[model samples]
Target: MFYRIHQFWQAIHPIITEDELAWVISLLPAPSLALFQGQPLPEQRHALDVAQDLWSSGIRDSHLLIAALLHDCGKTRYPLQLWERVAIVLLQKAPRKIWHTLSRSSLPLAASLQAAEAHPLWGAEMASHLGLDPRIVELIREHHTPHSQEGYLLYQADNRH
Candidate 1:
């Protein structure tokens, strides 16, 4: 629980250094680098950390690294404020019917909620449109699914920080 709180705080105020940006740019193509830059600072930091974790774990595949770096790019479409993120977390525990109703409501929260729920698919579509490798697109689309070994690693890394 405390870990989650720490994450929430971090998400609201992400800190990225110049060296980190340089390192990330070194790993991606020009267009993909633009997409990475489009992400919120927090998401950017998270992606960098995940990719670094994968590298430290001896996973050297460029596709996986790129996937980790851009997996949450979909969230850029509907950026959420800190409170909205909290609400989305709480909303996940609500019944499906309630969730659907809330998601469809006229409230501004609905957009962020919808985005949070659909980011994987949206991110995958974006990646595909950008002409990323099919494997990278697959990883983005199924980042939360946790069926394959790579997916599990991504999921674990995401949760860790």
Candidate 2:
């Protein structure tokens, strides 16, 4: 609960340091950098924190590192307000079918929920379109389900952020 509050506050007030920008530039290609920068500031900060967490833990696998940085880029496709973000998390308690149905609806809130739930798929597709490595694409795609070791590591790092 404390963490949720902290995240909410951070989402409402995000900061991106010059050091973080340098770190991103050092790691990402120009295309990926653009994609990363296109995200809401909070999401960009979250991605940097997730990637930094993985790198600090000595997980030098490039794909995992990159995936950690870009895992939530899909949120760019359907930018959510802070309230919408909160509602999506709360609504996760709904049945899977209902969630899917809501996501498919034409309503704005439903699309926001879809963006929240399906970001991994959307991010993976974006990565693939950018010619990212298969491993990186897979890591982004399976961030929630985590089929492999790197995927789990990415998932863990994302949560830590």
Candidate 3:
């Protein structure tokens, strides 16, 4: 895993400074760099790696990479926790119209279209507010939708060994 990370690190440089890089490196577990691949980086790093893969494939579209990186960032709230909270609020307080709106969306792992519909919007909204590029946010929003042809290609490239 470390070898892959080293390979990736050697290939793509971040937008951050040396000091920031050093700080990020210091925070990573020594073995984690070597042992964990792909899905193993800290949430942000995982996103970065995904973006790097997209870029390396000659996809110069930076927004797609940014979308790849932040796809699951909302998971920071913890999936179970957020779902439960959302459910409680919907059941107890939300208006019928709002509940109907929520019922149409997707869940991350569910096979339903609802799950697929939910991810891009949620991810894009959070990422854009965090100062991610507008285009990237668009990619994130469209990621799971049928409209995301280019972004999906980048995503597929990123996950392949």
| Candidate with best TM-score | 2
List clash counts for every candidate, in order.
0, 0, 6
Candidate 1 residues lying further than 4 Å off, grouped into runs, are 93-101, 104-107
The candidate 3 region of ten consecutive residues with least summed lDDT is 31-40
lDDT of 2 by residue, 132-154 (tens): 98888899999988999888888
Ranking of predictions according to TM-score = 2, 1, 3
Q: Where is the poorest 10-residue window by lDDT in model 1?
A: 152-161
Error at 126, model 2, angstroms: 1.1
Better of 1 and 2 by lDDT: 1
Which has the higher TM-score value, candidate number 1 or candidate number 3?
Answer: 1
Q: Which structure is stronger by TM-score: 1 or 2? A: 2
Residue pairs clashing in model 2 are none
- Per-model TM values vs. the true structure: 0.86, 0.88, 0.46
On lDDT, the stronger of 1 and 3 is 1
Q: Relative to the unseen true structure, what is the C-alpha lDDT of residue 104 in candidate 2, on a scale of 0 to 100?
A: 85
